[model samples]
Target: MKFTVSAAYYLLALLVCGVQADKEPLKDQSRLINLQSSRHHDVRLHCAHYPDWRIADEGDVLHFHSPHYPRLYPHSSRCGWQFKGKNEGIYFTINCQVFEMEAASGGKCKDYLSIKDESQQSQMFCGSQSPSLTVGNKVTMKFQSSYRKQAIGFTCTATAYLS
Candidate 1:
């Protein structure tokens, strides 16, 4: 098959990045997908609704942060997001760039972010520490704040891939 220069470049880039495409669609998005890191562009997220879901494509870099980032988040606020591969068999990973919330007290966090997957793995995060974690193609993130104290929320990016 004759390939154009751009086509060849695109394919080569995919290979170098370790992303692939197959004829079969992903049966279970939660278990069949794997995540790798890549940066293409930035997409800022607006947590206007209680829960929202977004589709991620290969090379997509989506950003999510608290309302009025770089400032104190509102008390008693809640937000959530769910990300899935736009195309079949695609995967993604999240890297937290900024994380600052009310620190945990007595092993409990008044304000925190929770990450969960279909595999039943759930993790809560708070304070200034940022976490980079791997999740299935389908994952959910929820941020909650109490009426005690507030701090600068979090900024995270989700990069999509395929394998």
Candidate 2:
């Protein structure tokens, strides 16, 4: 009878430890997910300060803005953004929620934003246009002013997908 009790106690201790070990990995995974979700702020800061391209994770909707957004951007300013998916199999979309720039003159934009895809397809916009576009897996965008005009700039959102 004493041996039976000892065996049961040892099994119970093992079960408890196994349960605890399972819980710990789950907790760590949850923490990692939370950190990834919080990367939006870091991405925005990086996009604002850097013009280089960066690959984003799937399902991450990243926000970017022109320098001094919602205010007059500097004259002759040049800003570029290149957003790519983590792999070539992924696709992404870009949409401008708020957009304003120098208006076109003589059928040409003095200050404009250009969006280009990996296929060499490109589009340019100016004035108060807000555009929504999708590219295969990578896209490049640039905002340029012709040293003569500045406006409220633009605010854009990009979301990546694995499709």
Candidate 3:
């Protein structure tokens, strides 16, 4: 009878310790998942700063414009979009649908749409004109406004294709 009681006590202790050992790894895994989820949220918040910015991949067509385009854009604001090709030899072509900004002071535009290519050269445009440009693999479009008078901003579309 004494041996039976001692055996029952030993079995009960082993069961409790086994359950605890299983729970520890599960707790660590839950904490790791929570940490990864928070990091992903932070990355999304960082991208939110460019409200009007867009990304275009190869064989995709994307339209971008200043904030509140067609109506006057806000003063002292900057916005842009980036286009990337899917393949190394792919390129992008862009067309302006409606382009209007504050006129240039001298030869340089005050409020302007700037197109930059992979070569790092930039072409600036202003006023009510439509322009077309082709760039290699990657292109970035930036629009800037001063603190003074504003104008209806630009509307443009970009298409990517293999070279």
lDDT of all the models against the reference?
Answer: 0.79, 0.74, 0.67
Model 2 residue pairs with clashes: none
- In angstroms, give how far residue 98 of model 1 lies from its true place: 1.4
The lDDT of model 3 is: 0.67
- What are the candidates' C-alpha RMSDs? 10.6, 11.4, 14.7
Q: At residue 53, what lDDT does model 3 achieve?
A: 31
Ranking by TM-score: 1, 2, 3
Across 1-163, the per-residue lDDT of candidate 1 in tens digits comes to 9886666656765786656544344467675556456545457777755667787878888888987788889989988888787766777788887888888999998898888876769889888767697677887888889998989898888888786
Which is the leading candidate under TM-score? 1
Q: Candidate 3: misplaced stretches above 4 Å?
A: 1-55
Which sequence of candidate numbers ranks them by lDDT, best first? 1, 2, 3
Select the stronger candidate by TM-score from 2 and 3. 2
TM-score of each: 0.71, 0.70, 0.64
lDDT of 2 by residue, 50-130 (tens): 567778877777788887888888887777888788898878788888898887899898888888988988889998877
In terms of lDDT, the best-performing candidate is 1
Higher TM-score: candidate 1 or 2?
1
Scored by lDDT, model 2 comes in at 0.74
